[model samples]
Target chain A: MEYRKIKDEDEDGAGAGADIEGLRGKAFSSSAVSNMPPVERSKWKRKTIVTLALTVLTSSQAVLIVWSKRAGKYEYSVTTANFLVETLKCALSLAALARIWKNEGVTDDNRLSTTLDEVSVYPIPAALYLVKNLLQYYIFAYVDAPGYQILKNLNIISTGVLYRIILKKKLSEVQWAAFILLCAGCTTAQLNSRSDHVLQTPFQGWMMAIVMALLSGFAGVYTEAIIKKRPSRNINVQNFWLYVFGMAFNAVAIIIQDFDAVMNKGFFHGYSLITVLMILNHALSGIAVSMVMKYADNIVKVYSTSVAMLLTAVASVFLFGFHLSLAFFLGATVVSVSVYLHSVGKLQR
Target chain B: MEYRKIKDEDEDGAGAGADIEGLRGKAFSSSAVSNMPPVERSKWKRKTIVTLALTVLTSSQAVLIVWSKRAGKYEYSVTTANFLVETLKCALSLAALARIWKNEGVTDDNRLSTTLDEVSVYPIPAALYLVKNLLQYYIFAYVDAPGYQILKNLNIISTGVLYRIILKKKLSEVQWAAFILLCAGCTTAQLNSRSDHVLQTPFQGWMMAIVMALLSGFAGVYTEAIIKKRPSRNINVQNFWLYVFGMAFNAVAIIIQDFDAVMNKGFFHGYSLITVLMILNHALSGIAVSMVMKYADNIVKVYSTSVAMLLTAVASVFLFGFHLSLAFFLGATVVSVSVYLHSVGKLQR
Candidate 1:
C-alpha cells in the first residue's frame, strides 16, 4: 500500500513542473480558495465518500444479517445460500467491470487479468474464506452466540499481524497501539449482559475460533495485497476474480454438505423475503470488502467492522430488548477513540 | 512545557558550535559505538527512569491506600491526617531544595522565590486541592465505591480540556483520541462485577463527582502551568510552595472537621501504624505528582493514575479474592494501548 503511495509522490514531482504553467493560469480565477487545488480536494473528498459508504453499508449489513437470523436457526441450507451469495456477488462485480471498461476502454488487469499467475492467486483467499465460512456454522454448535461474538474479535489482531508480515508494511508504534485498542474495544462491545451470558465455551470451540480468525485475517490481507499489487488495475476486475473463485469453492462445499437437499427441493428451498435480503446483503458486503481492500486496507476494514459491531449492539438495544450494559458503553467510547487515533494520528506530522 | 523545549534546542545550537572540538576528540575514542552521543543517551535514560518510577510509586500508593482501608473505615480523622501529609510533603520538598542549593548554589527560582507574585500563585491550586480532597470524603457518603471509581475517570477528560485551555497547548486530534481512550479504559477497569455493583448512584452523587472531577482537573493543570511557567525553577522549590499552601489549607479543614475531636483527645487520635503509613504514602505521592506535573504534564499524571487504577484492581484480585471479570481484562488492554499511543504515536513523525 505504501509502495503505491511512494510512486504517486514520484509522479507528482515529475508532473509539478508541467502543471506549474496551468496552476498560474488558474491562480487568477480561483485565488479566493487557494489553500488546496480543486483536484486534490476532490480526490480527498472522494476517498472520504468511499470510506463512509463502506462503513454504512457494512454496518447495515451486520444488522440485516442478525435480523435474518432472528429465527433461532436458518430454514435454508447454509451451503447453498453461501453459494448463491457468491454467485450474485460475482455477477455484480462483472457488471461493474463492464461499465468501467466501456467508459474507459479495456485494460490489461481490469478485464479478468490475462496472466495465469494472477488468476491462480485468487483461489488462495477464496479457499481460505470458504473454510472460514464453513467453520463459522460448525463452531456455533460448540460455543454460544455471545461467546462467538467475543471470539470473533480475534480477527482484528490477526489482521494486523498478517498485514505486517505479508504486506511488509511497517506500522508505527502508535498504529499498533491503535490496532490493539480497536481489538479490545470490539471485544468489550461484544460482552453480553451478565444475565444473558454463559461461560460454557468448549476447548474445541476456542481452537476453532482461532483457526477461523486466522483464516479470515489471512484471506483479507492477501486479497488486499494482490489487488494493490497492480494499483492501476480496476477494482471491479479484482473483485470479479475473487468472487468467481469464491463461488467455485462454495460450490464444492455445497456438493459435499447439501447436494441431496438441493437436488430434492431445488436451490431456493426454504426461501423467504428475509432470505433473499440476506443474500443481497451478503453480496453487497462482499463487493464493499473488495472495494475497501483496494482503496483502503485491512486496517480500514477492521475499523469498519468494529464500529459495525458497536452499531449492531446499539440497534439490538431497541429492536431485540438487549440490555444496554456499561461495558458496552465504555467499549464503544474506546472504539471511537481508536478510530480517531488511527485515521489522524498516523497522518499527523 | 514546549516553550522550555524550544529554549533547550536554541541552547543546543550554540553549544554544538563550541562542542564540535570536543565532539571530534570523542569521535576518535567512541567511534565504535557512535550512533547517538552518550550524553543524549543518558538524558533519554533518565527520562525513562523518572516515568517508570512515578508509575510504580503512584500504583503502589493506590494499592496501599486501599489495603489500609480494608477494614472499611478510617479510624483516624481525615482532616488531621491530610494536614499531616501536607506538612510532611512540604518538608520533603524543602529538604530537596536545600540539597540542590548546597550542591549547585542557590538560583533565583531554586530557592524560595523573592517575588511575592510567585508566592501568591501557589495558594490557588492549594485551595482547589483542599476542596477536592475534602469532597472525596463526602462523595463516598452518596455513591458506592465502585460507582465513585467510575466517576473519578472524568478527571482524565477534564484535565485534557483544562490542559489545552490553560496552557494554550494544541493537542493533535490523535492525542485527544488517546485521552478519550484513557478515560474510557479507566472507567471500564473500575466496573464492578454485576453481583457487587449497586447501580444506585443518586443524582446528587453524580453532580458531586462531576464537580470534583473539574476541580481536580483544574488544580492539576494550573499547577503544571505554573511549574512549567518558570522553566528554570527548581522543581523542589516549586513543590515546596505548593505543599506549604496545601498544608495551610488542610489546617483550615482540620479546624472545621476535627477541631473538637483533637481538643477532646489529641491531634493523632485513633492513629495506627496503617494510618501513619498511609499518611507517608500520600505525602510521597503528592511530591511525585508535582515532579511529574513539572517534568511531564497533567496528561502524564492522568496516565499514571489510570495505570495505577488498573494495577490496584489486579492486586485486589489476588489479595482480596476479587473476582476477575472479562471486563477488567479488556479494560486493561485498552488502557495499555492508550498509553502506548499517547507515548509513541504522537511522537512517531
Candidate 2:
C-alpha cells in the first residue's frame, strides 16, 4: 500500500487535531526531525533507501551463488535453497511485523478482523513469488553472473508492460524509450569479447533468463496492484501473509524434491558458514524487493537491479580478478544516460 | 516516523481534493478495499501477523543455531558471522529502500535535499545497533537457547524505563503490571528442573544475558524516540542510515579482530550452506526486531519475543527431542493471560 494513504486515513479516522496533539507530545520530542516541516520529509527518501538496499543485498546474493558454484562445494539443490530462503523470509517478515506492532501502537482490534477477512487474496501472489524464486536459481545455473546480470535487464521492459496491463499504469513514451535503452545498455555491458571465446553460455540459459524476466515482471506488477488496492493497510502486514503463502508453496516443493534428503542431512548438510551468509543475503534481498514493490514500483526495482549488476561487476574485478571489457564501460555510459533521461522525463510529467 | 502523520501532511500540502481524486483512480480500481471505510482496516491485524511471523522465524533460528552448535561443524567464529550478518542486513535495508522508491514516486529534488540534510542523525542509533548485535553473539555463546529466551525478557522492563525516560511517554499502571507478568511468566516457563540438571549452565551466562537485555532495551527505546521525534520521516530511510553506520562499525570490528585471517580464509571460511541460512535467518530476525520496535512499543516486542520463545520450545520438542516441562505449559498459560490483560488494558485506555 502507498504510505501516504495510510497516513491520511489515520488522520481522518482519529480526528486530525487530537491525533496531532497526541503525536506532538510523543513524536516532537528533542530530536532533529521534530522541527522540520512535514512536507520537507518526502517518502521518496525511504523508497530510494530500500531500493538501494535491495540492489546491494541481491547483488551480494548473486556474487555468493557464482562464487559457490565456482568453489563447487555447494551440493544442495536449487529448490532446497529456494525453500530455505522462502521459509526464512516468511519468518523474518513476521518478526518485522511484531516489531512494528510494538513500536507504532497503530494496529487496533478492528484492523485485525479485516486482515483475517482479506486472507483469501494472498495465495496468488505467493504462488507467483515461489515460481519466480525457483526460476531465479535455475537462471543462475544456466548463465554466468555477468551474463545473468545483463539478460535480467529484460525485466525492465516486461515490468513496464505488466505495469500497463495489470496495474493499468500507463508509461510515458520517454519512459518506454528509457526501458529499451536500459536493456540495450545492460546487454552491451555484459557482452563477451569476440576474441575471448573461452566462456560460451548455453542458449537454454538465455531462454531461462528471459522467462525469469517475464515471471518477475508480472509478479512484481501484480503485487503492486494488490498492495495499492488497499493503501490504508500496513504494507508489512500484507507482506507477512504474502511470505506465509510463499513459505507454504516452497515447503511443498521441498517435500516433492526429497523429504529424506532434507530430513537426514538437515537444512545445513554440506553447508559451511559462508553458505549460511549467502542464504541470509538472499532472504534479505527478497524482503528488499518486496519493500520496493510495496513502496515504489517495478520500474524502480529494475533500475536498482541494473545498478546492482554494475556493482557486482566491479566487485568481481577485485574478488575474482575478472577483467572488465571496453563494451562494459560503453554500456555503463549508456545506462547512465538512459537513467538521467528517465528522471528528467518523470520530473517534467 | 509514524505512518499517520505523513498522510495528514500530504493532504494539507497537496490539497485534499486533488490528491483524493488522484488516489481514487489508482487505488480504487475493482479492488475489495475500495468499498470499505479506511478506519475499518485497523493496524492490529498487521501487528498480529508480524508478531506471529517473528515468533516462527526467531524460533527457527534459535533451533538451527542450537543444532549447529551441537553438530560441531560450525567452526567459524561468532564475530565473523556477526560481521557478515550486519553487512548483509545493511545491504538488504538499502535494497528495500530502492524498491520503495520504485513503487511510491515520492522522492523529488526537495526530498533528496531533506534526506541529505538528515544523514548526520543516524550514526548514534546505528552505533547502538552494532553494539547490541555484537552483544547478542556474546549472549548466545554464554547461554543455552532456552536460558537465553527466558532471561532476555528483562529487556521488557528496561525498555519500559527507557521509553518513559527518553520518550517522555507515560505508561499506564496495567501496562506496567502486564510487563511484570510477562517477565515472570517467561522466567517460569523456561525454568529447568533441578533433578534434570543435565546441562550445567554457568552464572556468567546469566550475567551476559542481563547485560544484553539492558543494551537492547536502551537501543530499542532510543531508536523509537528518534523515529517518533520526526513523525513525517520515512522509517526505511532512517533504517538505511542506521544500517550504514552499523556496517561501518562492523567493518572496523572485523579489521580489529584479524584482517589477514578473514582475507585469507575468506568470510565464508569453514562455512556450509546451512551456515548461510543461519546468517540469513539472523539478519531477517534483526530486521524483524527493528520493525517491531519501529511500529509498536518495546512491550509488544517483548510479548512477541516471549511468544517466539514458546514456539522455539515447542519446535525443539519435535526437532531436538526435548521434553516439554509442566512448568512450560504453566508459563504459556500465564503469558496468554498477561497478553489478554494487556490487550484489554490498551483497549480501555
lDDT (Cα, tens digit) per residue for candidate 2, span B1-349: 1111101111101100111111222344325334436663334334444555566666777677667766765666445766677677778876776777777865641132345546776666656645655565565555555555455556767777877887787765445655665565566565553312212447777677666666667766776666566655666666656666766776776786547778887776777776788778777766766665555555666666676777778888889898765445545655554555455444335
- The Cα error of candidate 1 at residue A219, in Å, is 1.5
What tier of docking accuracy does candidate 2 attain? Answer: incorrect
lDDT of 1 by residue, B194-247 (tens): 512434577888789889888878887888888888888888888788878777
In terms of lDDT, the poorest run of 10 residues in model 1 chain A is A9-18
Instruction: Tell me each candidate's i-RMS in Å.
Output: 3.8, 29.7
TM of each candidate vs. truth: 0.77, 0.42
lDDT tens digits, residue span A163-200, model 2? 88888776664456556656656665565533122125
Structural similarity of chain A in candidate 1, as TM-score: 0.82
The whole-model C-alpha lDDT of candidate 2 against the native structure comes to: 0.58
How far off is residue B80 in model 2, in Å? 73
Evaluate model 2 with DockQ and give the value.
Answer: 0.01
Looking at candidate 1 chain B, the ten consecutive residues that score lowest on lDDT are B9-18
